[model samples]
Target chain A: MTTTHTSRAAKRPATSGAHGRHPAKSRQRPNWLGGLVSWLWLAVVLIPIYWIVITSLKTQSNYYLTNPFVPPGDPTLDNYRLVIEMDFPLYFLNSLIVAIGTVIPSVLFSFMAAYAIVRSSGANRFLRGVNSLFLMGLAIPLQATVIPVYLLIIKMQLYDSLTALILPSIAFAIPLSVLVLSNFIRDVPKELFESMRLDGASEWKTLWGLAFPLTRPAVVTVSIYNALQVWNGFLLPLILTQSPDKRTLPLALAAFQGGPYGVNVPAVLASVVLTILPILILYTVGRRQLLSGLTAGFGK
Target chain B: MSAITARRTSSAAASRGGGVLPWLALPALVAFAVFALIPLIGVLLLSFTSWDTLGEIQLTGLESWRQVLTDPGLPHALWVTFLIMLLSWGFQTPASILIGVFLAGHQRYRELLAVLYFIPLLLSSAAIAITFKALLDPNFGIGAGLGLDFLTQDWLGEPGLAFGVVIFVVSWQYIPFHSLLYQGGVRQIPRSLYEAAELDGAGRVRMFFSITLPQLKYTIITSSTLMLVGSLTFFDLIFVLTEGGPGDATRALALDMYKRGFQANLMGAACVIGVILVLVGLALALLLRRIGGRDPYASQLEGA
Candidate 1:
């Protein structure tokens, strides 16, 4: 037994030393190569974006003739100017309104429903079942629902209205939002709830005072996800709205491409750049929450 | 105490408390029912009938379903969708995992790399499509300038290549998301596990397989399932990049559904396609749920 212990103790440092030495060695020379490869990958990824920005700034004359890699001979905002002049602002506003409009109600509803589902005791199993059913919504691709949604929107006389966009967006967002919020809520201490209950706090008070405050990260995640979905939505908006004034950015841009000036590459790129600015800003700010939120409730 | 209990009881009675919380769900329930559930039901119903937008509806039973099963357009579209999903998911998923693992180790540049990678997520599909269009343009585009002219093709207009371009664009947009998932999962694995693995004389590869891989099982399932469902339903990028293109080369099921339902006014056929999409999504989701049913939070808590 003594010999075995000694051998074990003797083996320990050698293993530890080997383990410690490896990451240290990895941390030295090879790390630089790894970093270099990462940087190269980053460059490859960023090139298309760089090209977009450059092409968007070129004038019509230089756009076709200039080397695509180099900045335009006389760089101009003419493409952006054209997009603005051509009612891109209206599309932008329409998109913003629809996205925000959808996010608010969806978040509110999902929050309360999630609170109820997480806090309620006797119906927990039922709620879980319900939640799973709602998750089935994820499986029901938008293509399947577009026709029926369109018909329903028209029947309700909501066609050509921003309300049509808002309603559908909110509906689609609820499942994921509720899923995220519920998972976050599950993490809150039961002791806190019991303490609040002893203090005569109502469910609403507990939700607003305790749960919402703690679940801010999850809330932000859901909001950003919902916003991205709403902002980038295409098929629903395409089918529901008919008028140019009601068109979202994607629809408007599609029209720009398919219009008489078919494949005006530079102008299209400019419009595309302009449209993505808001989302890019949001992503840059809230990327962590967005990503964690996406993965959190995605599985079960 | 008796007086306080009586007051509480009376207040609770006054509040109509039992229904109030359920009432809160009413707005969302109504919205979902009206906009999602009802439409879905309508689509299922409509799938069994043949109707153009302007014509009288006629009961078609399994006719639309049969056509969807056999239609040359649908089989071609399904093949394209499967191919795009296979290639894009194959390329992007592993790349995301590697990037995620790499970034997880490097604390200093993690945020910067993440931001750079995620920039595409913020951009609109239309914008990405247009940007790619300019970048891939044959004669004067940057692709040509970089001696990539050999790689250049009429991405939107070419039958053989448009699907590939669309897949690349979609993969570029979504890879950051997958990476983020894996990174989160990696962050949740206990540092002690790494130390333990090291103590066991495990090399990096051994540690990754034994410690990291087992711990990240949930994340991998979740991210891959998301990718699978997302890829199968993918529409926006393809719609903008190729518009079911040059000869239906890039026509995904979603796009095909759109064409039939709206553009061609064949609502029944579109509904059938939609049903197929739902079935696929359901199968994938169920599979993912089974794999990820274990406590995902336990790892994070242990790691902490």
Candidate 2:
């Protein structure tokens, strides 16, 4: 690919004169209209987020009476304070634990399985069959599994614990993670692995030191995808955890919003703002990596 | 110390006997078997039996299946689910493609717009549902503030409007994903193609239709299928916002399954719904694979 890019660059000079003859005037109208429409569409897409943030910052009185488009007349931190006081911190921590717990083991196990499947000799067909089986997981919607999952959790005596959340979350994540990671690991240049083998590296060593490093971006992408799914997940937590202390952020937020304590709209929004902060920060840091990571399997 | 050393040596020797690779998958395979596959089988079996939460399982044969098929609620729920899927795909896919094309050349603002559009994807669906619930509140929401109170119909309460609201929320949450897919597809086209089209005095629209859309066919099929499957199985946001209320107007199959299986403890009926959901997903997946002739993950794998 790099060679192709360089070769293409070398070929550019012969076409330079023809390209130079193209008038800027001919392109200006489309570019201007395109720019304007893109910006307008972006604004429309962002309005809900803007509304959420603005509403979160508003005072209770301002929430009901102020113009929703405008900034609050007297913005207050009371809502955030209230949410914190309501022990949102605990829910946040539970969510963090579940997300990280699910991600780490899910990635590790899937990486190993994917690596073995991709690199093992004479098993490509068998591995593809395995891959298709895992793909079936993608079709099995969570609603279908929730009852059985609940039953299994009960039978295992793990209900209302973080284990109940972590175990199923990891199970749900593994099939897709393995599918993604195996595809990625399969794409590692065979020459690199052969070179590593010539140097007397073991299979595990080659996978860990060579293939894994090259696949870090894909790993991060998969991890983030898995984390987001775990974090935003509601049904599993809703059915599995009966205790408030065991609740995750989404389930906790639902409880806060729906409870008989009367609707504290500002605080609910504040909790949302807080819940969304980690993902936003992660996105800011890794937006490009995320895009490339997400598009890894896009084209054939 | 000597015993431990000998044990470690024996284990190492055993690992060298071609068992290491299979052992590596043991944890994952076992976990999936116990938690995912076994339970799924259990649910399938349970679907054929009559069992309340408190009672013993009894073979009911096809009774539950028949009831689920004949249930009035099932058809309505199926209809709502299909409508949401159709509406979301109908509106969001074209809009995303247009936005993706429009943003392709303008690299400067592309990152910014992508970030903004992706905000909903990052936020919890429950949070977004609650936020929209507030925003669409008839009495004091932003809708009323904008004097579009006429637009402030009970978004989650009015049967006529509830499905539309759910579709909008689902589309809003996913538009970024499709846009990102299309953007990547557009980026994959060699810039030289566009330049050549320009040299031929082709308009931007013509260039896009002639060059870009064909190149983006794979992405379009993939994103549309994803959106369809996603909308079909969707539960959280609608469950949070509407609870399938306003007379089951917004009840998707997944939500209906939840209400039946867990809320009502009608295990057999819920499992029947589950089977239907799986069938829908498989059909969509097969359709996508047929049209796109490529897996969505294939490109990501190569890039990796």
Candidate 3:
């Protein structure tokens, strides 16, 4: 469907402009609108985050009396103490268990599947079909399938357990992970594989020795991505698990906000802060990998 | 014994130069089939039977569908869902593009802004909804503290304002992600096009429209598809934020399903809603792909 005119309309520049690193270095015309919107959007994003952090530090009484925009006059960790006292540590551990449980198997299996799909090189019908199945899986909303997943979990007697969360999380993570990992795997040089083949290396050996090293960054990206999804997942825990002890951070956060402690705004915001702190730390540690991987992963 | 024989035969097939690659995909395939694919079909089947969460399912053909279809709530839920999908897409697209174009600049400050901008995306929807819920409280919220009477409106208490709040919060969480996509898209645009336009004395606005907008067609499609389809799963945020609001004003289809199935104990009815949700998502995705004007099954599977 791409007409000649349409294809040429936004075609890549013929010169040395590779992947838009430095777009128009000479045409330094000031972008007033872009600048204005950038700064404005920055405020819109930051103010709430800023409010959440500072307000979390405030006493509930001070939160009521003080200028909401201003930093707390007297800071307190009482809210944090209160939130932690409410078994947040349990929820945090449950989230951690679920995240780790989901990420490892999900990433490993997806990596294996992706390697198979990429290695088949479009010649293998079964691999091609599997690849397409994963692609179709991407478009299916998780909400649509939750009902039966719930039933399956119950039937398996895995309901109300962390394993219940882990199983479904692994399935949901596979499609996107396979897509991204396969894309990365396809970029590995065919010559390398052929060279391994010449040395009488098994496909599994080449997969581990060559592709694994080359695609480690993608693996990390997929790991962090899946970790985030599982860590922040709300619905599965909301429905599958019933025990208070089995609550993940998100499900626990919702419960904390809606429970009898709901009226304690400081404690509520404190719990929110607590739930986000671990990911914030992870983000800080792997900002570039996470951000760039996300950008390139989706912006193709 | 049967499992061993099957494995032996598969290994025999694999050793015959058919390659072991296909076998490597088995774990993921089994997992997806059990938990995702089967559940998809299971949901459809469940819609034909009636079961509360704790009970034995009863096969009662189109009865559940009939009840769901007759209910006035279904239309309202669909409308609310459609409104959120449309409005959120409408609101997020332009802003994300502008900010994306802005962040595409290679300035140090813009880099810093990009860092902070993505923080909201890092927060779980539950966290974002909870934060917004507390922050927008009419009595104990920012408006009361700042003494801004206009801002002091019952944000989540009133129906219209609650719907608007839901859309705004969704945008606040997602625009960072879409803008990041736009930034990457903008970064991929050929610089020479801008150079050519510049030589012709094109202004910033002119270059953006003539060059940037057209070049970003695919990114727009990618982001739009995620936004439109992802809005269908806006359960946790809406559930936590307004619980579908004062009078079901913000009750989306997913939330409606949850209330019906989990709260009201109508599993069959909920499955019908789930079926509708699946169909709508598939239809929208196909529609967007059609608009993209590519081979329907083309291998451009780049998304989060």
Question: Which runs of model 3 end up more than 4 angstroms from their true locations?
Answer: A1-29, B1-16, B295-304
- Tens-place lDDT per residue, model 3, B1-304, is 6345435433443455746888899999999999999999999999999998777999999999999999999999999999999999999999999999888766556777887889988889999999999889999999999999998999998999999999999999999998887877777677788778878888778888989999898888888988998999899999999999889999999999999999999999999999999999999999999999852224334312
Candidate 2 lDDT for residue A163: 92
RMSD of each: 7.7, 6.5, 6.1
Model 2 score (lDDT): 0.75
Ranking by DockQ: 3, 2, 1
Model 3: per-residue lDDT, tens digit, A1-300?
Answer: 111111232232333245434444556667777778878878988998889999999998888889998998789999999999999999999999999999999999999999888776655789889988898898889668899999999899998999999999999999988987887777676667767776888878978899989989789888988888888899999999998999999999999888999998988999999999988898888886777555444554
Give per-residue CA lDDT, model 2, range A1-300, as digits (tens): 111222233334456645532232346455555466557767766787788788889888777787788988677899899889888899989999999999999988888888766665323344455565676776556456677788789889999999999998898888878877876676676667667766878777977899899888678878888888899999899889899899999998889888753377777888888888877898889765555555443432
Best by DockQ: 3
* Model no. 2, DockQ: 0.33
Question: TM-score of model 2's chain A, to 2 decimals?
Answer: 0.84
CA displacement after TM-score superposition, residue A275 of candidate 2 (Å): 1.2
lDDT (10s digit) by residue, model 1, range A1-300: 111222233244356665533242453334343356456667877988888888788876676667677888677887888889989999999999998999999999999887766565324444555565565665556556788888888779999999988988898888777766776776776667767877888878988999999878778777877888788888788889899999999889888867855466777778888887776776667555565555555422
Candidate 1 has what TM-score? 0.87
Model 1: per-residue Cα lDDT over B126-204, one tens digit each = 7677667667777656656665756565656778777677877887788766776676666656677777666677766
Candidate 1 deviant stretches above 4 angstroms: A1-37, A122-129, A261-263, A284-300, B1-18, B144-148, B290-304
Between prediction 1 and prediction 3, the one with superior DockQ is: 3
Candidate 3 retains true contacts at a fraction of: 0.66
